[model samples]
Target: MSTVLIVFLLYLIGMVVAGIVTARLASKSLDDFILGGKKMLTPVIALSEKGTDMSAWLLIGLPGQAFKMGIGAIWAGIGVWVGSLFNWLVIATPLRRLTGKYNALTIPDYFESRFGDSSHLLRITASILIVFFFTLYVSAQVVGAGKILAATFDINQVVGMVIGLSIILFYTMMGGFIAETWTDFFQGLIMVTALILMCIVGVISIGGLGNVFSRISAVDPKAALLSAGESGTALYLGLILGGLAIGFGYAGQPHILMRYMALRSEKEVKKAMIIAMTWTTFAVAGAIFLGFLAIPFLRGEIADPEHITLAFAAKILPGWLVGLVLAAATAAMMSTVDSQLLVTTSAITEDIYRKLINPDATQKLLVRLARIFTVVVAIIAFFLGLRAERLVYWLVLYAWGGLAASFGPPLILSLLWKGTTKYGVFAGMVVGAITIVVWYNVPILKNFLYELIPGFFLSLIATWLVSLFTAAEQRRTK
Candidate 1:
């Protein structure tokens, strides 16, 4: 077998081993399976959160956009960095405290408890949106895995996707959250190390920063400009706004925020934030530079820009080293898919099934059902990935916009602002999710700016406006 294939297979096996080892522990209960029993150490919390946050989109989609758009793509990187920082500074400690205080297991559960919503409307609504957008989000990761597998093995994309899905399903189902977190910790390291190495090697290969800039200008001068030097005011503003808007999702991403709740304690948030941001800085910077690096090498030769990182790596690295680096890239995808898989599983088994349907379900039964839904959800995403011809970057953004808009506003307001009502939370979730769908589908609207910006704002507005009336009603009634 080729060294790359061998290395890839070994990485896959290691992930499965991590899952198998953790499975016995995670299988103890629903909380253990989904939240690692809230016993996660600082490093696991930090790395796993970053790993889950970056995904294939970081290595493939972001770099590809950067490659195609040049320096203008830096907005996306900045957005992600700031967004993660926002999560750390603003979202992490409070979410961990609030979730722990209420003993809430999932995002939906938190909503129900926080608002004292006896109607179950808030939980059910939030759960539906989580499952829907998460399924879309998972498919994007599956597509990333398939793309990497196809690039590495020279096989059909569908065949590659199946292989990727099978491995993801096994490890995710077996080890549950603990397995995914431990594996994410390692995968996070691989992603950062490999990307930084690629950046260093790439700059050296191109004769340093000066030569890199000269070469970038030689290829696409506009790409090196912010807004790509668009003359039109609206177009220029849109690029800047849209790029910055990417960060808006950070506050709301269930997969990443879920990590905060899983941390050992609120005390760990600061240390974990430091470690996580360090990884984010190095990895995201490397990815951004790699995009520019590819501009000078594989510009016209590449068919799918999303495959730029893989193609560029194959160009510079030797055979065996290529195997190791590609494994890291694949790690990017797995880290994300596993998180989403578990989160989606949590929504179904804990939020929808156990809470609403079977209030008397046992921990063992819930754990078993979560595993089953893990496979079911992954299979559904696998099929979606097969038919997904869209770029991973945009597909991911669409889903990200939905989740951020739906949950980010409500969660933030509810945690920080005591006035946030359940009716307002429900309104925000609906408006935010629906706006993404409507805005994304309308070509003119999507082309104007990213849906996240408008959706996020509208959701916030909806939450605020609705909360006023509801909060007043509660006061009067009391």
Candidate 2:
């Protein structure tokens, strides 16, 4: 075998071994399998959140946008950084405390407990949403993994996808959250290292930042503008708002929030927040710069702009290093997919099966059900990935918008507003999800603004208004 193949295989082997070892620690309980027994330390939680948050979007989608659009792409990065900072500062501690107090294992469970939903309506609705949107979300990551493997190994895309999905399912199903968290910690480190190294190499090769901008200007002067080449003021402003709205989605993402919920203590949240924010800044900056730096080296050579980072790595790095970097890119896809898989499994086994179907089920039975659901969800996502036709960025954004709109407003309100009722939370979720579906499909609406922008506000309004009306009715009846 070639040195590259050997190196890549060894990395995969290590991940499999790690999964098996962590599986031993999972115990027979659903809590240990899904939440790592709530014992994750500061670094593990911080890095796992970062790893799961970035996904292949950091490696492929963001760089592709920067390469295609210019400095305007930086707005998305800024939005995410700011959004994450706020999420950590405002949401982390309260959420950690609330989940612990209520003995909630999932986001849906938190909503159910906080609002006193004895009917299990909120839990069912939330799990359905999780299953629906997360299927598409996980599929996007699968598609990304396919792209990475195809580019690196010259394999068929479908074949590459199967290989990637198989490995992800193996580790994730074998060890659940424990395996996913440890792998995410390692993958997070690799992701940042790969991005930083790629950026440094690209900058040096192009001579400097000045040369990079000049080359972009030479190609399309307007492309170098931060305003995204829009002529009308309204259009430019809209573009900026839409890009920044990407951050709003962060507040509601269940996979990222799962990291916060898994924290050992509320006090550790502050430390994790600092580490996460610092890591995000460097990682986002590096990914964006990689795109700008690729202008001179890969202007016309590659067909798909998303492949810029991988192609750039192969051009500059040695064989073993190239394999490692490529593996890191794959790591970006796997880390996110594994986490989402585990979350989806929890929704099915804990929320749907245990809570709704068999309230008396034993811990051993729940763990077994979780494992079965993991494989089932992975298979479903793999098929969806095969059917996916959009670019990684759009696919991810579409699913991101849906989940953010559906869950973000309700989650925020539940934690911050005492008036938030079960009725209001339910309304917010339904309206948010419906708006995304309608807005995204309509050409005019989608062209004007991202689905998340409208969906988020509408959902917030629905939640608040319905909550107030219901609270007043309850007072009158009493």
Candidate 3:
């Protein structure tokens, strides 16, 4: 075997060991499995959240966007950064306090408790949405893993996806949240280091920043523009707004929000926020610059722009470093896929099965069922990854929008507005999720703006309007 392959194997073995070690901490109950018993420190929680949040999008999708659209794609990065910062500032502490206060284990459980939904409608609805969108979201990450593996080993994409899925499932099934979060912390460092190294090396390889821009401008003037210059003022405004709108979805994403719920204490939120934002800013900047630098190196020879990072590693870096970089990229995907897998498993076992099927089930039984569900979800996502035809960025964004819209509005209202009722929560989720689906299918609407923008605002409006009437009804009934 090549030296690169050997290094990659070593990294995989390290992750497996991490899983086995953490598995001991996850034996107490479902809470332990899903949230690491809520004892995670600041750094582990922060890095794990960032690691899960960035996924393959940071390494492949975002960079590809920058390469294809030039500096204009910076809007997406800025939006996500701003959104994540605010999510930390506004949602993190309260969520940590509230989840602990209510003894909630999952997002659905939080909703059910927050809204006083004894009927279990909110829990059931939220659980279903989690499973639906998360399956697609996890599939996107799986597809990215397939691409990376295919690029690395010259294997078929389907085979690559299966291999990737097996690794993620094994660790996640073995250790649950403890394993996933700790692995994510390690993976986060690898991801940021790889991105920064790729950026620095690529810039040096292509002469300098000045030469890089000059070459790109010569190849395609439109690709070098920072804004929608010739695309008209309306288009420019739309692009900026749509890009910024990406941040709005951050409030609603279950996978990311779960980190807040898992924190050991509300005091840790401030420290964790600083670490997460700093990491995000640098990591995103590196990914974007790496994309720009790839232009001069590949000279437009590549068929898929998303594979630029992996291709650059294989071609430009030394043998051992190539393996390290490849492992980092794979780390990005695994960190995310494992978290989503755990969340999806929790939604089924914790929310649906426990709440509806058997309220008296033992902690041991629930933990076992969670493991089984993890395998089942991974298999379904594996198939979805094989059949996925869209680019990674769009696929991720599509699922991201759905989760943000469906869960975001209600979540925000529940925390801030005492008047928020179960009816309002239900209305917001349904409207938001439906809006994303309908808006995405309509070519003209999607062309003008991203589906998340409309869905988020409309869902907020629907929730607010419905709350007025529902709150009054709740009062009168009382």
Where model 3 places Cα greater than 4 Å from the true spot, the runs are 209-211, 228-230, 387-397, 476-478
In the order shown, the candidates' Cα RMSDs to the true structure are: 2.0, 2.0, 2.0
Which candidate order results from sorting by lDDT in descending order?
Answer: 1, 3, 2
lDDT of each: 0.87, 0.87, 0.87
**Poorest lDDT segment (10 consecutive residues) of candidate 3:** 387-396
Task: Give the alpha carbon lDDT tens digit for every residue of 1-478 in model 2.
Answer: 2777887888788789888888877856899999999987789889999999988889888898888777778888898898899899988999999999999999999998887788887899999999987887888778778877786788998888898888888888888899999999999998899889888877777777668778777876766788868788997888789778988998889999999999998999999998999999999999888887777677789888888887888888778878888888889998899999998999999888888899999998898889999999988888777765464345556788888999999999989999888889999999999999899889999997889999999999999999998997535533
Clashing pairs in 2: none
Model 1 TM-score (2 dp): 0.95
Each model's TM-score? 0.95, 0.96, 0.96
The number of residue pairs in model 3 that clash at the backbone is 0
Cα lDDT for residue 188, candidate 3: 96
- Angstrom error of the Cα, residue 205, model 1: value is 1.4
Which whole-number lDDT from 0 to 100 does residue 103 have in model 1?
A: 91
Measured with C-alpha atoms, the lDDT of residue 187 in candidate 2 is 91
Which ranges of candidate 1 are over 4 A from the true structure?
387-397, 475-478
- Summed backbone clashes in each candidate are 0, 0, 0
**C-alpha lDDT (0 to 100) for residue 187 of candidate 1:** 94
